[model samples]
Target: MASSASSHGSINAADHSPPPPPTASAPVQAVENNLLTPVALSSVSLHGAKNTRRSLLDHVFKPLVRESASADTTFGDVLARLSIANQKLARYDIFKEDSIRVFISEALEQPQPGLHLDCTNLDVSISVKEKSRLVLSAGTDFGNAEGSAYTNAVIRNILGGAETLSVNASTGTRTRSAYNAVFSTPVNGNPDLRLGLEGLRSSTQKPWASHEEQLTGGNLRLAYLADNGDSHALAYSGVWRQLTNLAATSSPTVRADAGDSLKSSIAHTFTRDRRDRAGNPMLSQNGWLLRTVSELAGWGPLRGDVAFCKSEVEVSGAVPVLNSIRGGLPSGISVGGGLRMGVLYPLPTGYSLTGPAQPSRINDRFQLGGPTDVRGFKQCGLGPHDGTDAVGGDVYAAGSVNMLLPLPRAGPESPLRIQLFTNGGRLVALKNKGKAGEGGPTAALDSRAVVNGISSAVCELADGLPSLAAGVGLVYAHPVARFELNFSLPLVQRRGEEARKGLQVGVGINFL
Candidate 1:
């Protein structure tokens, strides 16, 4: 052993104790999960806002910043604030999809020394990519009753602050020609409120009524969204309508109403949608929907040739149907029901409520029955008819109940399904004693007659089950709309209502 020790050096531990664990000039801080840790927002900056206005950004971020300035605010809370701002920007339709991103880091510079020195301060940077300023497209539109090919031009963020200008032109089978221009902007830089001005011209053929309606008009509207996801809209509209180009087989009711009329009106609409999925019948297996509209025409400052008070309400609900035997129904089946009702009451024109009550006109009346409404009936078919034409009605009530089943071997993600449905409705016209009295300074309204007409109509609606239809169909939920092909039969119908016997194809965004 003495000889080996003489030949080699012996190993030993360092005497410096790992150099005092590598001490720093300042106190070391532990890295933490910033998301859960409390922190202070020292500053926030927005990037990629070339087309946006500074004032609009201030309006959106001022409140959020004030909230985040509290000492207890966590980094998670700051992220939530950023998320909300991102949503608003996306909703403005001025940003590219998924183009918003956030970056967080330690502040390069700290605020002046303060009592809250224990709080860690962080900086936030939000980056967003704007969409193209101009967009043009040509496409086709399939509405509830009409289909058309259209060309659209949109100017996004035209004047900054998410303002938009849109122009559209279209021609179609039912709509002979149409053109419209609209300018819309956020009110006071609040995305939840919008103000819009629109001008439109259209010539639409109503073959169901054996007439064509030409319209030249414009409207100013203010739309608001509440915190609970309800929407409200108020609009003032002035329109000039001409009923012309009558078919050879036009009905006397249609012929009598063929002329030019002016309508100056104010309207309010309220809507609430609480569906699990919007516009997807198979996926909307829970919750309810409601919409109401009220309008007044030719009253007070709004003076025109047509005078009436109109109200409409629609409600629908869906519930999931479960099967206990198999744990649940395959693909989550559902049952849904809907009801719609409308009324048009005559009102005196001018400032004098004593004037003779004007009758509801054809242009202002309601027409029920269609694939999107009541199945097995022709478009505008469940209403008053004269000769071969559907003259429409002043009051109508429609309802439908449907059950949807998943296709064999199809999964819940599939949009195709089988549907069994039953629907019924009735439309009635108010009996008018005579036309409006001419220049009625001395003429007075016959309140008794109006009351009687309304009462009779209501009594008739309550007298029996409405004209009924039953059907089975295949439903396809398209991304843009819903497609349905049904084999329907009219279980019961009125004398003049037109019922489609065998197969009917329907396409639109809304359905009963």
Candidate 2:
């Protein structure tokens, strides 16, 4: 895909630094004076413009999704009813500006909405070389809330693995327009340690403060690794970012491909308390962890994370022995607390680290699925408590999957990717097997989401299998240009309905 996230800002023409530190969390190739200086459009941009893609609003989108004027349906009915006879996917254009339109649905085209954006651009310009290996990406994001901006880049796949570096950048106001190359050479043919830089420069748009705000800052990152073809791998990264009118957000986790063994994991993020790079505010918090398996099998590919969360946050972080299984429980639970901030993907205002608000889409992650996380009942989650007396920590380990078959060929730029998938997860407290349906003893955690206080109670009282939903949508291929139309879909329906009304569709970049 030729970079699609609206290129608004100008690029910086100067080469500010040598290649970034071998391991910077997220490094911004220092901007000269951090100034908003306008310059002539880059020659590369005119080349891009000449080759610009046709608008998605034209032929392709119209034929893909359209309006069916029904004799029996009102605008509301037409909005509520899809062709499947009473089964409606979503409402349309609840609000519309001259160039923008919207849709609302409970479920996405199909499939589960994982953590990362599915694809960066509607045009699929990136592909693995061999199709045998899955490329894992690690790096940092930079931005400035004081200005408006956009950026785009590509990842080259070697042997089906993402192993090359490519990029494009621009600010909203044409203040900067330059591309910085880092880690140009594929590191040991390993996609895990791939170097990628994502940043933003946004200026406040007036009259949006009530609904949206402005934020400007820069975020950058570098990641690389050496893949030995068999089991061993080495990877690292670092990021440095500042926000002018910014909002805080949750922590991020680096992921591994499915079925691949040979374990390795080490990643975390840091933030300053202030809005800009200058140190007017205190340091908020930081996160880090490392885990390597002596033996890959049965180790289950160990994973860990530490984060500086919001003040409403109860706790965060874990101790070393926490991963050590002693009598079936970790030695200790992670602990820390204070007013954590908010950082949402594809933020609402160019200034804040905001994501789509509550009524729309939710892409922020709190904790993994388990006892303390989503507080409910599922597979085999029952065990004893090991948390501190005051901390109130409980344990529940679980796993689940969701699948879907596309009515269409799954391709890179096809705006509509649909399929069906089911998901499941469970966590058990080695000591206490809480009854199903009853939830737990406490009113807060002890609700209907729990087991009836016994085994078999899990399936007996429930209406059907342990299934909820999986949502999907489009994400501009580039990482820095936050133009994500995050979406989702629901599986089961409500009473008197053969299908489900549980579906929810909003605009946010939360799908994995």
Candidate 3:
């Protein structure tokens, strides 16, 4: 029998074919392989930066060009250098977001006399659109426990070298009226370093202490970022503070410190933040943070009405309990904890013969409890109390532990989460054994007495269980701030501490 096939080719019954491997384009392949073809940078040109100084551009790009223009330089090296330059420009905040464009082409001529013939000469061009010179904004804002209406104006590249001038004014329930002006510029055209001068005037209400304070001040500040991504700031401030508007029920402690005081102070602040989500600093699914502040007032040559040394430290960390299995969302639980501590030590501006030194002032002391700090307690509630007023403290310690669970349908990326938290703290006011009679105040405290008081306060804070609270809350992480609503109760509390029961609402940028 002869089997004849049709016009079409015969198909095999068991034939199988697999899809072809993906083919990437030249640029994609180059990036994947980190293209190392020998190249040299011949020239670089910048376009569209009208307000930015040419010297600033030169300062930023000179080192990059020098590094990438070598005969042995590769295409990858040039691209990396270009990226670094772009980042520097972006950090200056002079350009619009994502408005920078880079173009690269083979150079028509090789300028180097002894250049290698085998290496390709390339030209790089960058175009950037500067942001608007002036920005004005007005809005209503909510802070820790109060709301305010504010106006802000900013002038970018004010003096052509990525300098900025900002003016702000606000009126609020707690902050009656405030005005601030700041002028800042990069040091030596370095984005990592900046210098600023600021002037501020404000009248603020402190109902927690039953007093209002008015301040007029100016400061000179230098800020820089370290190689390890830490940020640091050094500043000197000259402030005139007048404490007034005391409530009828204001405690004697508040009344005693209510007066005009001049503070000539120097301060240092250090911060390190490593969190998974940069967009919302309030809710971190992972990573750790640390911030420390130190201030010296009226010591040695620095002269001021008040004299003290103040230090504060805050540390927090978060860890994931599970990995995400969903696409485009985080579907895991996280646990976080935070600790904050502060101390204010009294210092004598000058030597005295007979009387003791003054104690830490209300403004210079540490205030411990608030929605942004130890929760479930009223604002400044964990501190030493005089009648109905929380007098703050000379030394304090606070901490919190929280478990965050993603909302059932919202997912972890939603910026909304369910939080279970416990918070506790202690605030102690230093006592002076050498008090002058029953009514009059001493000039200053003895050095030995101040030291002993601080030690005793620290020991008391560390000795026993702190005033504590526990609660469950709904957390919303807005770009500008964090908001929370919770029904909470105090689990452990000291006498005179104000504890909140039932539902409470909180709004702030930072939380314990």
Candidate 4:
């Protein structure tokens, strides 16, 4: 009985001996150790920084560490938090490239064990290389209006505060010359809130109207980003505008409003973009944009020479279609559409208190047509005309529908496609003849006579129906720009309006 008991005790002792050392993989053991051990962040240091204030870095990274574990945090948790902090620093645009390197100061010679375990108190060091702070560049750009050359100098990270200052000058065929200076900064050190100020002097010629306009102005802007990735901006601008060099063929309305004018206005814009890319649209991408603007000029105590209120709204969107045929050509197709409408009304007090109330100025009226508007007509061709020049209208409406299809033999990823489209629009002038208190031709001419004369003039070239056009085009969409050549034919037209029957070339960011 004693021998049996001794054998049993030996067996129990053998059972109690340490099982063989774990043969599990290194990663498994590391994970186990990370789950078991507690670690604390001892210190953090930044290296290779010049011109950047250390306080700014502290402001950016300190918040990330505020919630870090005081006692129960594991090594893995500390490493993860450090990695996240590094990513946050990269978003400042101060770095050149993969600009962050994190390491333990004491474990430089043995990184593997430091990464897995063995370090209870961690001292993390971050190294970053700064990007170039000053840049000077000159380039040429072409648009639907004409070609232009520009030069600009930019200073970044100004005063170690990540602000921007820029000076630019540009000249084009139609736009004679322009100079601008701009300064921008983050508001209250919050990257999402931006404030900017800009001053500019510009002169432009309108060949279609046979006139030139000179403008000098300055504006202040504030922009903020919401949590849903939408952006909103508010701006105030004060400008002096003068129309000169009017040819003998200039429209009467143009001549009336051709003299110098002062305009002070405030505007706001909101944009919500959810597309996969801003420069190019993909079949899978879906997004929409809406913009509304209201401007008051020469109204109230600070009223200027001109008095009018203009309100405009525009909306555009793109959406994927025919998704069931994933392997066919329909997979690459999308539908896009947009609508634009605007109205201009006169401010009564500004003119009533001053001299004779003038009509809304030609410069502020709504003009429609051309490649950017209704594609089958010349620029401003859909509206009222004074001789050969478009006098524009007080109200305008335009809309378009397009089906974007991939061209045959083109790869699925190609940016080239065929666009089948139909667009239409109309513009009408608001007549002000018989409203009470408004001055009309004196009682010299009978009211019937005046009305008949006005009716005859309007009926001579009136557009009873909205201009309609249908066509197809080849669209080459680049990351930064888009170009198209459309073959459009007008289905409906006005009596005296000029319309383009054949191919029309367009260049801009989008069809709408």
TM-score of every prediction relative to native: 0.89, 0.23, 0.90, 0.78
Candidate 3 residue 208 Cα shift, in angstroms, is 1.5
Locate the minimum summed-lDDT window of 10 residues in model 2. 250-259
Where model 3 places Cα greater than 4 Å from the true spot, the runs are 1-26, 30-34, 110-118, 324-329, 350-356, 433-443
Cα lDDT, all candidates: 0.79, 0.23, 0.80, 0.67
TM-score of 4: 0.78
Q: Whole-model lDDT, candidate 1?
A: 0.79
Residues 1-512 of candidate 3 have per-residue lDDT tens digits of: 11111111110111122212223335777565746788766666666776677667766677766676466789888888889889899999989759877777766654455445687776666767889999999998878777799999999998889999999999998899999999999999998999999999999999998989999999999999987899999999999999899888887777777888999999999999887777466678889999999998987678888888899999999998756555435555889999999988887785432234478777887887767788888888887887898878888888999998978988667788898999999999886633333224544667788878888888888777899999999989887778899877899889999988767888887788
Report the alpha-carbon TM-score of model 1 versus the true structure. Answer: 0.89
- Model 1, range 35-137, lDDT digits (tens) per residue? 6677766655666677777667766666666676677877678778878877787878888859876666666675433314566676565667789999999
Could you arrange the candidates by lDDT from highest to lowest? 3, 1, 4, 2
What is the lDDT, from 0 to 100, of the residue 310 in candidate 3? 92
Count clashing pairs, candidate 2: 116
- What number of clashing residue pairs does each candidate have, in the order they appear? 0, 116, 5, 0
User: lDDT per residue, candidate 4, 1-512, as tens digits?
Assistant: 00111110100102112222323335667666665566544445566656675555655556544434344566676667777666556656666657666555332233221132434554555667777888999997666646678999988888776678899999997899989999987776566678999999999888777789899999999988886888888888899999899997776556766778888877787777666564354332357777777776776654676666778888888787777767544366788888988777655434343333345666677778887668888867787776787867767778998888878989546788898888988776656432222212211223343344335434433346678888998888766556778998998887667788899887655456
- Better model by lDDT: candidate 1 vs candidate 2: 1
Candidate 4 clashes between residue pairs 3 or more apart in a chain or in different chains? none
Over 295-378, each residue of candidate 2 has an lDDT whose tens digit, in order, gives 110111222111111111112221222335456442222222221112111112222222221110111111222111211211
Q: Top model by TM-score, which number? A: 3
